[model samples]
Target: MSVCKERAWKTLEELSFIRVAGTQEELKAAQYLKNECEKAGINAEIEEFEIDMPVISKATFEVLEPYKKEYHVIGIGKSGTTDENGIETELVYIENAVDVHLNHVKGKICLLHGRLNPELSEKLIKAGAVGTISIAGSFYDEKSIADELRPRNTFGKGGQLPGLVMHISDAEELVRSHPAKVRMVLLQDAEKKGISHNVVATIEGSDLKDEILTLSAHYDSVPYSKGAWDNATGSITVLEMMHYFAKHQPRRTVKAVWCGSEEIGLVGSRKYCETHKDEMDKTIFNINFDMTGVTLGHEICCVSASNDVMHAIEYLAKLENNALECKLDTYSSDSTSFAGAGVPACTFARLAPMGGAQIHNHYDTMEHLDPDSFMITLNFALHFAKQLVNTTTNLIPRKFDEVITKKLEERKKWFSEEKDEKKKESEENKDEKTKEEEKK
Candidate 1:
């Protein structure tokens, strides 16, 4: 069946409210997703969890000018005691907060180029950045991508300073507004704690029912970002796939997971795995779809650390693009949780920005989505699931190295066949040229 790009983009465009870590908007998106899954005929349900020192939406803040609201502080922030007047420090531009220069951040306000990586946030806080300023570009469509891309917008007050992230242009304008030793006095909610839930659905197989395969995507997004591409694309992709598969039916028991709080340190995936370690341990593989569909370039790349999984994914994407190569040992996504544990797993995405990173920008929106890419990914995943189901003897095979080696061997034969075809084409061209010269 044809999946309409206009319709898919419209779906993401309408849910501009979804953000990460259990906000009202996120819940709304979740409910909408659950409805979609049910409508498509998939059995779906919610799974909840709690995070200690959670940087959820409730611990919200904004830059106030003592009398008027100056900058709205979105997401998590420091909550304990502060220097009443809020630390007034000069702004320091951090090219990459994740790779922050410790010596330079001491007692200064930090301006980050992209979204915050939690690891970077902890390190920078430890480095002594009084606060943080982030730039969110215009192309951002999904909130999930923002949550993962941005530093949890959280702060643990009294750690020498606080942090806040905002759009690049808006931040530039905010920083320029009355630039005289600008002081940002924001609140930190270290004490506020809460709960978040993940929704899971299962399609049991009769044969190897004990073995399992998982398909995952975060249901949350950043507070301000609707998370269309960041994850609404991913989350929706899973539901759509689930609907299709449920009707078509696969051999292995497939679990469709709508993870929660994934935007914050993989909390949802981590918690879910922990809660179902027994069953998860039984899992042979996990297929993670983070971002799919693009109005611009469509470079569906596969990421996996295991040799076997990588070999399999790369084999699946062999005919994609010569310039766009699918990595064999790449492992960075919601699937990292399971993949890290040695359960053969990999992540699927439509595009990979030049080097080796996701298109971590707001421009990763519906405006840049291509429905054709989405359908390709959806169908490829469906076929891959079929292969995985058929290969019941080797889910997370005992030796991933062997798995990849075997797959690569097959690839060599395929490439040879391709080369032979090109040779024939060249020969045909030469023949045509010879005939023309003879006629002349």
Candidate 2:
């Protein structure tokens, strides 16, 4: 009935696998979590949603003119496809692809140093770049996984260019070589779709059954990772909390959600909010767990709610002697989805120090986590949630400060612009098709 670290660890081990988004493995993990909740006498169900799952058939990057050699690469999903013979053009190193670098990138394949956000992608498309190569991994990465480039996709609408992600070491070499010409071949089905799931469990309150306290953790892992520290630990943490709440019924309803496809831009959580939009009015708070149970890490909480709530959590941590650093900001996890939907939310994580434990790769195994360290976070979170659930009055304010409100507004504007761009592109294509038919 209590939060048992050992039981949580065992469950984490059982669900330890590469549960990539929209894959069978991810569905299996979702089902497993649903079953575990049912076994605890909690009512659980799996809600399915569609996700973009592009299929890359073949992708290659080759250098010509200076040195004739090919490098291993992975295609960027949804980034359009190249011709049968691929695109051969001058290779230009654009460092960060600022405006200064874009002046000379016309009809060339640009090499970008950092992340390729939607704004940058739009700039590149407007600058007439034929293809792109993004860097990934560190030069000091272990030889075993040095070549493992994580697959990524272009976000937003339109401005889709064929792209590849190269290892940092390889990218360094390619830039140093100063190859005049390069060829990039990307063949894929960009319109493909797949299904992902969210496991939802509910424990009705004794009095205020309408009011809900949502507990969430993503269960999906990235490619080539078992996700032990990145998220499997968080998933189990929520499960343990569910076990506790099942035994001691709170005054407010408790909802546990194991989100899927979170690694791919929090798709699962966003969908959960949209599907349950009608219930958002009654949802009081959302407590999300991202990562925990690291051997060498510190507890942190990112509160996307009001400053009052943030101060309360900080005070509670200090009162309980829990070494937690609480801050008022939007975290890049499922909690952000809830916050965007006007639900006061926060994400609890035990972040590892630099050179401690890495994630999103094969290195994120159980080697860096233990049950004792795991319990520390779970215990503190239990105390925090218990107080709120049993409190006589709702302490969380349903308002964001000016800074948080601005940030949320900016996010909404960006998403709105993306939708408008997509609609415009769709209309343009339809116009072209109609003109062609009229001519025929």
Candidate 3:
């Protein structure tokens, strides 16, 4: 049996449970990753970080006027709560929250087309909408199978109202039958502190020890998913890489990270970069694996590296007789966190064919993944890492052009703004405390 394949399957089985971000299960998976590294005679450490954990007390929606019925729904986390009995008002099917719809949506319950970003949530709050219900899943999907909706950190630390998500079948019924009015109840604790971790295992280099190459994969899955295809495969793949490097130490240091809370805006990776800013300059490249191992999947290399590195990867793939669709861009994963911090990064994914597999839902089980497809990507990563890390000459320089720089700047802007907001809030709280002391 191939070493990579055997090791990957073993790690995948160890991490087969539903490990949601900031939960005990996620910590357990991180520990398992650390244990795997130790088993390979490599020492690993768990880095702890605090994240927001939204605790929902109630999330439900009911059509009152047209028909008295309740639909399964999930409350948008950090989104403010509704009244004790919920908001019962006119229901408007604002297909898209355009200007025309915004004018008439005031004092009503709006059913939005999809999830709301920070900008859209601000618009809705300003438009005087009391509550929102967003649609998820597809009309083609069985109504019985509802996709779980967990609120992301898109709203940042502010500008969110009560919102819930319903399956498309129920949404279609609401639109077709034209429910005159509905009620949305979303009661959630504002946001609480929770602990998450990242597992880091290092393989010391022989020659160019100062130069570093990092490999990462997120082990956490979204709600209601076992995540065998979405990421258990990627996590195991990175573990196998760690095993390989332990056996054959490279000329440059290689760090493998199993990140937690990627489903929640790459929280684990963001924390890693924030805490390890000193090392960012020395890091030359980061290769991140997200999802793979589907029987009917194709390989994608979303490269945020320089053009020279992109060309080298293409040439290397051709030489190795591997087929990959490479693009000079950024992907929405842990790699993006590093790329945004000015570290050259690329993300590898094997996108499952349409309807062949499902992710972020209960159906993302182990049965849908193929071990053969898993090995294909594993070999590609191994070969690519060997070329990049063990090269006698520096084949590629760490640099980004105007296009990539602009993208990184755009992502960085939001983080900076969030920090400023928090700072301002802290000062305000301090002032209020002073006033209370004066009164005392």
Q: Candidate 1: deviation at residue 176, Å? A: 11
Per-residue C-alpha lDDT of model 3 across residues 1-440, encoded as one tens digit per residue: 32567667767876888999988888888988898889889889999999888787898888887679888888777767886798888888787878998999889877888876666777888999887777788767764456565455444645357877778788888888887878888777765779999999899899998888999999999878888887999889888888888888899999998888999888899999988899899888999999988888898888897888787787788887878878888788999999987799998899977777888878888887878999888899888998879998756677886778888887777677678878998999999999999999
Candidates by lDDT, descending order: 2, 3, 1
Q: What Cα-based lDDT does every candidate model obtain? A: 0.62, 0.90, 0.83
Which pairs of residues clash in candidate 2, taking residues 3 or more apart in a chain or in different chains? Answer: none
lDDT of 1 by residue, 143-223 (tens): 444344354533222233455556555566545553435455555545455677788888876687777889898877754
Q: What would the per-residue lDDT of candidate 2 be over residues 1-440, giving only the tens digit for each residue?
A: 57776789899899889999999999999999999999999999999999888899989999888779999899998887998799998998887767889999999988888877777778999999988888889878987787667888767663368988888899899878988888999999987899999999999998988899999999999999999987999999999999999999999999998999999878899899999999899999999999999989999999999999999999999998998999999998999899999999999999999889999999989999988889989999989899888888888889988777788887776567757976988999999999999999
Consecutive 10-residue window with the lowest summed lDDT within model 2: 152-161
The order of the candidates by TM-score, greatest first, is: 2, 3, 1
Say what the RMSD of model 1 is: 19.9
Per-candidate RMSD, Å: 19.9, 2.1, 1.9
